[model samples]
Target: MNSDIRQLEPKQLWNKFADLNAVPRPSKKEERVIAFMKDFGESLNLETMVDEVGNVIIKKPATPGMEDRKTVVMQSHLDMVHQKNADTDFDFDTQGIEMYVDGDWVKAKGTTLGADNGLGVATIMAILESNDIEHPAIEALFTIDEETGMTGAQGLKGGLLEGEILLNLDTEEDDEIGVGCAGGIDVTATRTYNEEDATEIKIGYTIAVKGLQGGHSGMQIHEGLGNANKIMNRLLFDGFENFGLRISEIDGGSLRNAIPRESFATIAVDAVHKEAFELEIKLLADSIKKEYKTMEPDMEVIVTSVDAPAKVMDLGVQEGLTRAIYAACNGVYRMSADIPDLVETSNNIARVIVKDGNIKIGCLTRSSVESSKMDLANMLRATFELTGCEVEFSGSYPGWTPNMDSAILKVMRALYVDLNNEEPHVAACHAGLECGILGTNYPEMDMISFGPNIKGAHSPDERAQISSAQKYWKFVLEILKQIPTK
Candidate 1:
């Protein structure tokens, strides 16, 4: 464990965070973190339960005078999405996260900070250790595989928690309370064709889109971060109509939930037009950069050469793949008409790859309304089918539907007004949260999510505002203390 981070506020919480940061607890590889949590709970003399998939449930009795208050489940996920900058040398499964304090924020060096849900975990730990705060029975639920799939929540059996009220610690913003979130479905499309020889007598160049500020697809999708794959596809389709360019290899995007920051395509073109091709690529990049100046100022596009000449995709396959990706949904399609400034329906063209004898494309669709989500997914499936590609959809998790008149929402709003002299902003998030799935598992439960201000989650630019942590901590403590006993 790094000794320096132990100096941060809430010493024990930061100490454990730094220790877990050194354990390489990326999604699906959380055994060490799980063990650490289990050991911590055992040391606290709390009843602990861990499922086969690494989801840990630690039950703690209330503070001395609040034993009769209603039990509240403080929940957060255990796993985190591992993302690093293109230049970072760290390995997700082996190396520890290198974190540092930047002014009033905490961030990782050239990688994601893992604060999306880590703050929630650490706060629960701090609450568990605190004898001063008063609250009812607390079931600290730590779920697994939240970044990729809601596998832990989906596979959850009933009767895990005794609490009917759940507080989700996954929201990114500090001042806003997340009452609802979009449900999401993963749609994959694939096409296979026989390889063909490079018949076009053409020069080869790699067209690349880079430097865009890619962020969490759900959280920052509205921020207008450029999608490299989509931009590259647009450039190729629009520019190459007058030239003969066939893509030999195409690659872009990393995580299913992050806006792609960079993408590259190797193309075969006529030797005579090499100079013109480079000029066009430059122009295209400049055009996109100008278009998204406010959101992605660093966006860049480039052309280069590689040695692999024999392996090339068929022109038919290339055209079909390009059309499928370009035609599919790329950004927020519809804003919520019901809620002002809320994104009601959106789609992320997640990833594209040529693997295992097939060219596959993954798209994630999200919406707060269940039927709206289905409509978007169906639209993408229809679009892919038009390209003669086979498509499949995963079983989607439900959205956490909002109840503006919720009892807990009322209490939280009142508490914020009492503490901050102003009402907290109540809104729904575009990102997927486990509250939806968990709510389904326990239908009668009331759920809401809130967290410290974490910017650029699931991306290399991730940072947490240190000032927000103290406010959130104080607010949480006050809420627990104000709970009424039966």
Candidate 2:
């Protein structure tokens, strides 16, 4: 139970995490969490204010003898990516996350653990509400909508902060210090298709692709894990090519940042081809399962018979749509030549929906290079446009350029070495972070990111390492004390 979660060592941190999880704070719908943070700052009698974009800022004076240190902006996002299992009955907008302790990790019941940025937020909150911890003049920045569009970071006006340095406590790996991150853009394709009447000779069937381990699109895109949308499209493409399958509706994936884990579709086929359709689909399912048996051992492709739909998509449009999806890029597009083993450009076919006479496909394309990013985006656009989709690009953001010569980077590297007796891996990650956007407004603030171990982010399997949190807490305290003097 969360009661046990609040009792975790360093009660200051876990207790705050428990408090924050009690409020529903889905991305783009952060009113309650924003208010909760505002009330929290006010309760402590700190200087609190809400920005025009719904970000909450709380300022706390320095501790005794620490007034000479440069001010620090401790930052984390307020909203979380809301994802749940297909069988988990939960409402992200109305209910708090149901959390529990499992060995050395805390997780939610068949839902996302929200540890991506929630842990960072809780860390800042703990320090803000504490009187015993030593620190410089603290500015706690809680930005909203970070999981979706990062509008809070983008809309933040300049000259609002007095901090000379920034500590972004949002990175996942404990053994790495983040110096840069990839930028991203949202690509959406939509078009209307003519509906054809389902003849009496047609029979209906449902196809479901589930049990895949979906994760963060940018961070885990290179893992070769199963993508439900791609997998579902493969089956549909094959079924139509062989047995003349007609799709009535297709629904796959949830958010553009998360790899698709589950997809379901309603399709129709001629009565004469029913047996062939089932046999071919199941055979292909077995083959596909064998292909991913190592990475996705629990992957299942379920087929069931149902009542035929009243209408189905035109054959020409269906053919084009399926082919375009099959041809589009879904995983790591390019690996960096400068950074070994790092994905430089990638795309996530995050969402696919087909209903009535409308079809929409959503993708999130990310890259460290602006030219490479647009190159892949245009490639996807041309592919979809050939199939008659009107594509629009939005939410474009720049990547954080690496600064190995940074003053804070030097301090944190030395600090990590002293604490763990080992050098931390200093590298740029593929995930999207708000630091790059915030830097545009505060150009001189030296930024760095580090955090505890979080695995399977942007998925239901998300969990935080307990021992790593304790180690990070120790590191946070030392970093605060070592903040460079003015």
Candidate 3:
């Protein structure tokens, strides 16, 4: 735990957050964090249980005179998106996150801060451990695999939780309440390729696209930020058509939820056209720079000499893969007709890799409307299938429709108005939240999601504002105190 963080306001919350940072809790791999939560619950003499899918449920009895209020389920995921800068050397499976106080915010060095849901998890831990704070019956629900897949929320059974009101703490903005969220599906396309000896190539070079500000695919997709995979493919397709380039390997992106920041490809160019190819690449880079000058001023395109590979992808496969990727849909597809500024449907071309004998492409499609989500997924499937690649879709989750008359929403809004002297912004998010799945399991539960200010989630530049953390903690405590009697 960092000493500086322990000195922050809401001391208990910051202390618990520091403790969480001392343990590795990457998405889909949260055994240590789960154990930590269990031990913490036991230490408080509270009832604790782990569900079949690893979701942790800790129950705490209400304080004297508060038992009459409805049970409030404070929810957050245990796992976080693990992302690091290309130059950083850290292991997500074993190493604890190294974080430091950066002026008014807390940030990790060359790596993600994990504050997206960690702060929420730590807040619940602090509440469970504190005896001075007043609150009604509490259920701290810590879900797993929220970043890569919402397995914990998906597998959670109905009737297991008795809470009538759910307070989801995974939202990023401090001033907004997330009343609903978009559902999502994962799509993958794969095609086996034949390799042939590299005979026509005289010079080999590695082309790289880097230094772009990759963020959460859903939250930041509408920002018009550069997609590394798309940018690299543009160069590859142009080179293949005009420079007679032969690709040996292609790799880009790391996670499906994150916009790709870097892409690399190894290719060969005939010695006769080397100068022309270099000139063409330079021109292409210049053009791309101009296109994204304001959004991605730091974006870089570099080419350097490399050893020639013994094998290269077949000409047909190379052209087909390049063309399909270039033609694939990415970013926002539709905007909400009801809610201003809300995304109704979107797609993220998240990852691409070429290895062994095949090339694979991965995409995530999201929408508030189920039919629209499927329509976009089918569109992506058709685009890849037309290129002779096999496509599969999985991990589909339902969207949460907003309830304007939600009881908890009214309580939280009144509480926030009293605390901040102003009404909070209420809206639905484009990003996938566990609230959608949890709502399905407990249809009667009144749900609302809000949290401290967290920026750059799913990226190395992630940070959490300290002042907002303090304010959020106070706001939540006030909300707990005002929960209506059941």
Q: Which candidate has the top score in TM-score? A: 2
lDDT score, candidate 1: 0.82
Backbone clashes, candidate 2: 0
TM-score for each predicted model, relative to the true structure: 0.96, 0.99, 0.98
| lDDT for each residue of candidate 2 in 1-486, tens digit (9 for 90 to 100) | 899899998899999999999999999899999999999999999999999989999999999999999999999999999999989999999998889989999889999999989999999999999989999999999999998999999999998899999999999999999999999999999999999999999999999999999999988999999999999999999999998999999999999999999999999999999887889999999999999999999999999999999999999999999999999999999999999888999999999999999999999999999999999999999999999999999999999999989999999999999999999999999999998999999989999999999999999999988889999999999999999999
For candidate 2, which ten residues in a row score worst on lDDT? Answer: 273-282
- Which 10 consecutive positions of candidate 3 have the poorest summed lDDT? 195-204
Q: For this target, which candidate reaches the highest lDDT against the unseen true structure?
A: 2
Better of 1 and 2 by TM-score: 2
Candidate 3 lDDT, 1-486, residue by residue in tens: 378888988899999999998899988778999998899899889999999999999999999989999999999999989889999999989888888898999999899998989999999999999989999999999999999889999999998899999999988999999899999999999999999888854689999999988999988889999999999999999999998888888899889999999999998888889889999999999999899999999999999988877778898888889988998899999999999999999998989998667899999999999999999999999999988999999999999999989988998888889889998999999999999999887988999999999989999989999999989999989999999999
Model 2 bad stretches (over 4 Å): none
Question: After TM-score superposition, what is the CA distance of residue 427 in candidate 3 from its true location, in Å?
Answer: 0.2
lDDT head-to-head 1 vs 2, winner? 2
How does residue 258 of candidate 3 score in lDDT?
Answer: 94
Q: Per lDDT, what order, best first?
A: 2, 3, 1
Error of 1 at 476 (Å): 1.3
| Deviation (Å) of 123 in candidate 1 | 0.6
**Model 2 misses residue 244 by how many Å?**
0.8
- What TM-score should be assigned to candidate 3? 0.98
> After superposition, which runs of candidate 1 have C-alpha atoms over 4 Å from their true positions?
1-4, 355-357
